[model samples]
Target: MKKVLLLTCVLCLAASLAGAADTIKIGVMAPLTGAWASEGQEMKQIVDLLGEELNAKGGLLGQQVEIISEDDGGDPKTAALAAQRLSTQEVIASIGTYGSAITEASQNIYDEAGILQVATGSTAVRLSEKGLQYFFRTSPRDDDQGKVIARTIMEKGVKKVAVLHDNSTYSKGLADEAKAILEEQGIEIVFYDALTPGENDYTAILTKLKAAAPEIVLATTYYPETGLLLRQKKEMGWDVQLVGGDANSNPDLIKIAGADAAAGYLMICPPVPKDLPSEEAQNFLAAFEKKYGGTPGSIWAVLAGDAFLVIAEAIKATESTDPEELADYLHTSLKDFPGLTGLLSFNEKGDRVGDVYRVYTVDDQGNFKLLQ
Candidate 1:
C-alpha cells in the first residue's frame, strides 16, 4: 500500500509540473502609475486584448499565452527594477516602455538575461545603435522625424524658428536633430534652449521665446509640457506657431491647452490606427473600440500592440521561445509584417524600417487633422 501511494504521488507531481508549463509567458514593462500612466495603461489593455484574441484562436504553439506586466513608473530607476523582476520570471520576450531613458535602463537587463525586448515608443536613435542583439523597437527613430519637421518648416516658409527641448534623452535628441537639419537648410534658429518639464507654468519660457521673436517654435517635449506651453503662450498673447514633436500626439494636449489655445498647433508623428489605411489596422480599431470602449488616445500605445504582433509572429514562424531563435528570426527573416502602425520590419540596427511621420494640425474643435 505504501509503495502504491508513493508511485501515485510521483505521478501527480509530474502532471502538475506539465500543466504549469503549458503556457507561454510574455512580459510587459510600462509606466503604469506615473505621469505617463495613461499611455502605459492603454499599452497593457491592447496587449491583453491581443493575447486574448490569440488564445481564442488556439493560443501560441498549442499553449495558452500569459502576460506578466511590470510597471516602470516612467522613471529610469523604477524601470531597472521592473526589468530585473521580469527577467527572473522566465518570460521569453518583453515589450514596453514609453520613455527613452526608462527603456535604456532596462535594455541591459533583458539583453544579459537572453530575453528579447521590443520597445514601443522609445525613439532615441542610440537605443538601437548599442548593438544589443535582443533590443528592437516598433517605432521609428528620431532622425527620421527631425527631417520631416525640418521639411514642414521649410514648406511653411518659416525662416525664423525657436527649438526647445525638455533635456530628456528622447526630447533633446529630437530637438538637436531638427535643429541641425534646419541649420543645414538655412533656416534661422532664433533661440535654442531646454526647459524644465512637469511644471504647471511656463510663462517665463514663453516670455523668453516671444522675445526671440521666432515665427515658429519647434517644441520637442511630451504632451503635458506642450499643452502648458501652448496655453501659456496664448495667454501671453503670442501668436507664434508651435510645432510639436511626436511626443505631443496625445488628446490630453488639447484638453490641457483648451481648444481655443490648441487651435492651429502643428505636430509630426506616425498616423494613429484610425488614420492607417491597412485593413488589419481598421479591424484592430474596431475590436479595440468594442472591447475597450474607445480608440487609443496615443500612437505610442498602438506601437505597443505592434510590438506584441511582431513577437507573436516571430514565435509562430520560428515555433520556439528561445530568445536567440526569436531574435534571429526578427533580425533576418521578419519583413513587412503588417502591423497596426504599418508594414513593420527591422533593420540591422533594430530600428523599425521606413519613414511614416505625417504632419497634423489641431483644428478649433481640438480635432487632429492630417495636413500633408
Candidate 2:
C-alpha cells in the first residue's frame, strides 16, 4: 500500500511540473527612468493593463500570463544587460528597447539567444535590416516618416528649407531621408546641420540657419532636444517654420518648450488619441484612463498600447507561450488584426511601411492638435 501511494505521489508531481512549464512569461523593455522615463513608464503601465485584461479572459493557454519589466535607462549597454538577464529569467519574449541606440545595442544578444523582440518605439531603419531575425517595430521607420515630413512641407508650399538633426543614428538617417526627398522637388535645402544631443541650446545653429532665411526648419529629434531647439529659436526670434519628425509629435513637446516657445511648430506623426478608431483602442484608452486618470497623452504611449495588443493577440493565436511560435503567429496574424494604429503587416525587412503620419501643429495654448 505504501509503495503504491508513493508511486501515485510521484506521478502527480510529474504532472504538475509538466503543467508549470506551460506557463507564459512576457518581458517588457523600456527606459523607466531618466529623460525618457515618462514615456517608458507609460509603456509599461499599458502592457500590464493588457496582461491583466488577458488574465481576466482566462489567461493564455490555461496558464496565467506573467509579465516581467526591465528598465534600460535609455543606455545601450544597460539595455543589453537587461536583455541578457531577462533571457536568464526565461521570458518567452520581450517587447522593447525603446530608442534606436538601445535597440542596436541589444538586437544581437536577443537574436543569438533565439529570443524574439518587438520594439514598441524604435524607428530607425537600420534596427530591422541586416538579417536580425527577431527585430520588429510597430512604429514606422525613418524612411517612411522622413518622406511624410517632406511631403507635408511641400504640400504647405515651402520652397526653401533648412534641415538639422542631433546626429544620433535615428535623427541623422531621418533628416537625410527627408533631405533627399525634398531636394528632389527642388525645395532647395539651404542648410543641413548635424549637432550633438544633450545640448541645452542651439543658438548658433539657429542663427546660421536664420541667416540662410529658409522658410522651413526640419528638426529631426526626440522631445528634449526638440524642445530646446524650439525654445532657443523662439528666444532668437527666428520665425522660420519649425517642423519635426514623429519623435517630436508628443504633446509633451509643447510643455517642455513652453507654450510661447513651441507654438506654431508642425509635427508629422501618428494620429491623436481622440482620433484612434477601433475597439481595441477604446479598451486601451479606457483602461489607461481608469488607472492613470487620463487617456494616453502622447504617440509613444499609444504605440506601446498597440504593441501590447500585438503580443496579446499572438498569445491568443499560438496557444503556446514559446517566443518563436508566438512571434510567428504575430507576424502572420497582425496583418489583419483590427487596431488603433491601422492594419499591421511587416514587409520583407520586418519594417512597418504602411504607417500613417498625422500632421499636427502646436496651437497658441501649447497643445499639439492634428492639422487637417
Candidate 3:
C-alpha cells in the first residue's frame, strides 16, 4: 500500500512540472551589463511588469507568461549569442538588444530560426529595409526622426548647422539623414564628422565646431559622450544651440553635464505624453512610478513597455504561442495598440506607422520639458 501511494505522488509531481513547462516564454535581449546597462535594466523592469500584469489578468491564452532575460552587453557578438540562446529556449517572441548595430548582428540568427523579434529602441532604417518578415520595431526609424529634427532646426531659424555623430549605427544613420535634409533645405552644414563614443575629451572637435560658428550644433550620440561634449562646449564658451537625438533624452545627461551646462539642450524624441492621451497611458505611468520608485529613466522604458504590450496582445488574440503564427498575427491583426507612448501599429516594413517625435529641452530645473 505504501509503495502504491508513493508512486501516485511521483506521478502527480511529474504532471505539475509538465503543466509549469507549458508557459508562454517571452525573451528579452538587452545590454544588461555594459555601457548601456541602465537602459537594459529598465527594459527588463518593463518586461517584468508586463508579465505580472498579464498573469494577473488570467494570463495569455490561458497560459502564464514567463520572461526570459539575457544580457547582450551592447555588443554584436554578444547579441548574436543571446539571440541564439533565446531561440534555442523556444521563446515565442523576443524584444530588444537596443542599438542598431547589435540588432543587425543578431537579426539573422532570429530570422533563420523563424523567431519573431520586436525591437524596442533600434531605430536604424536598414533594419526594416532588409525585408525580414519576422522582425518589427516599436520605435520610429532614424529617417523619420531626422526629418523632424532638421525641420525643427530650420523652423527655429537656424541656418548654419554643424552635425556630429558617434559613429554607432543609430547615431551615424540619424546624422546622415539630418545632413541630407539640412542640405536640401539650403541650410549650410558647416562641420560634419563622426566621433568614437568613449573618447574622454572632445576639445579638438569642439574647437573645430567653434571655428565653424554654426548657429546650431546637432549631435547624434549616446548620453555619456553627449554629456562630455556639452560640458566641454560650455567650458569653451561656444555660444551655439546644442541639440541631439533620442539617446540624449536620458536624465543621466543632466547628471553628467551638470544642470547649468545641460540647460536648454534640446533633443528630438518620442513624446512622453504628459497629457495622458489614453487611460492606459495614465495607468502605466502611475503603476511604473509606484513600482519602480521614480519616473522612467528614458523613453526606451516607454518603448519597451509598448513592445511587450503589443506582443502580449497579439499572442492573446491569436490564442497561440507559435512563433510563426504570432508573427503573422502581429503583421496582420495588431493595429492601433493604444500604447503608453502613442498609438502603435506596424507598417508593411514592420516600422511604426505614425510620427511620434517631439522636441524636448532641459529646463533650468534640469528636467526634460516638452517644447510646444
Candidate 4:
C-alpha cells in the first residue's frame, strides 16, 4: 500500500507537470487597417477567444499562450516588414498574412528563419509551389475556389459570360482559371475586360458591357470596386446577371451598393457560416457574437481558428521554440487534426490538402445560403 501511494503520487506529479506550458508566442499578421480590416479584426478576436478558452480550460502545457498581432495594412512591403518583425520577436508560430499578395511577400521571411507560417486566407495558387519548408495554409486557395465557381456557373447552363477582373494577382489568376473552365464547357466570352481597381468611373465599361448583352457578368475583384461597378451598372440600367468570386462575398457589398444591387446577384464563395461543420463551429460563432456584438464578416474563424489550433498543437507536441522542430512535428502530426474547414494535411512543400468549399448566394433579402 505504501509503494502504491508513492507511485501514485509521482504519477500525479507527472500528469500535473505535463499540462503546464511556458509562454508560447504565436505571431498574427493580417490587414487590420485596410479594406480587409474587418476580416483581420475578426481573426484577431477569435484568436484571443481561443487563448481565453484554452487558458480557462487548462492552459497550454501549464503556461498560458499569448498571440502577438501585426497589421500588414494589405500591402506586400508592409506585410514582409511585419513578418520580419514578428520573426525577430521569436514567436514560435505565425497565423496570418490574410491575403495572397501579403502571404507571397512575407512567406520568404518566415521560410528563411525556419518559422512555421499558417496563412489563414492567402489563397493564391503559387503559394504552395515556393518550396518553403515551413509554409502551410489553413485556407483553400483560389484554384479550388475557381473550380467550384466555374462548375456552378456551367451547371446553371449560362453560356454567354462577360469577365471583369481587377488585373491584380489574386483577381487575374482566378479570373483566367475560371474562364478556362467556362471555355471547356462551350461558354462564349462576350467581353473580357481588366479594370483598374478603385477607379471612380466605369461608365464606359458598363456601357460597353450593356451593348454586348451577356447573360452573366462575372466579377473577380475586391468589394470596393465590385460595389462601385455594381452600383454604376444598376444606375445605367444594365440588367445582366452579376456573379462574383469570393472577393465580392462581403455582406457589406450589398450595403455599399444599396438599392442599386441587382435583384439576383449571386456571389460564389465558400460555404456559409451556419452551414459549416459541427457544434464546435456553432459554439465559436455564438461566443464570438456574445463577445464582439456583431456577426463575423466572413468565415474568418474557419481560417484563423485552424491556424491557431495547428500552431498550439505543434508547440504542445514538440515543446520547443525552434521553428524547424515545430514545423517537422506539424508536418507529421497534422494528418489527423480535423479543422472546421476540412481535414488538414500537408505535402512536403507545406501546401494544404482536403479543403472543400460550397457556393453562397447574396439575394435581395440579404440571406446568404449555400447555392442549391
Highest lDDT against the true fold, candidate:
1
> Looking at candidate 3, what is the lDDT of residue 317?
86
Kindly list the per-residue Cα lDDT of model 4 for residues 1-372, writing each as its tens digit: 999999999999898656433567788898898888877887888888888888887767667787899999888899989998998876778888676787889888888877789988777888888777888887777878788878877877887998988877788888998998899889999999888866788888888887887888888888778888878888887777777877665666776777446447777766656777777777877887899897677765457887888788777787766778878877776686766655677767676776466666666676666765
* C-alpha lDDT score of every prediction, in listed order: 0.92, 0.80, 0.86, 0.78
Provide the TM-score for each candidate, comma-separated. 0.96, 0.91, 0.93, 0.89
Model 1 regions lying over 4 Å from their true place? 1-17
Q: What TM-score does prediction 1 earn?
A: 0.96
Worst 10 residues of 3 by lDDT: 270-279
Worst 10 residues of 4 by lDDT: 16-25
lDDT of 3 by residue, 1-372 (tens): 999999999999999879767798889999998878888998999889978988998888778888999999989999999999998887878898688998998888989988889998899989999989889989899999999989889888977999999788899999999999999989999999988888889999999888988998999998899999988888988757788988876788888888888989999998753544778887877887899897677778678888898888887787777777877887877788888887888877888898888888988898889885
Best by TM-score: 1
Residue 59 of model 1: what lDDT? 93
Ranking by lDDT: 1, 3, 2, 4
Report the Cα lDDT for residue 72, model 2. Answer: 93
Note the residue pairs that clash in candidate 2: none
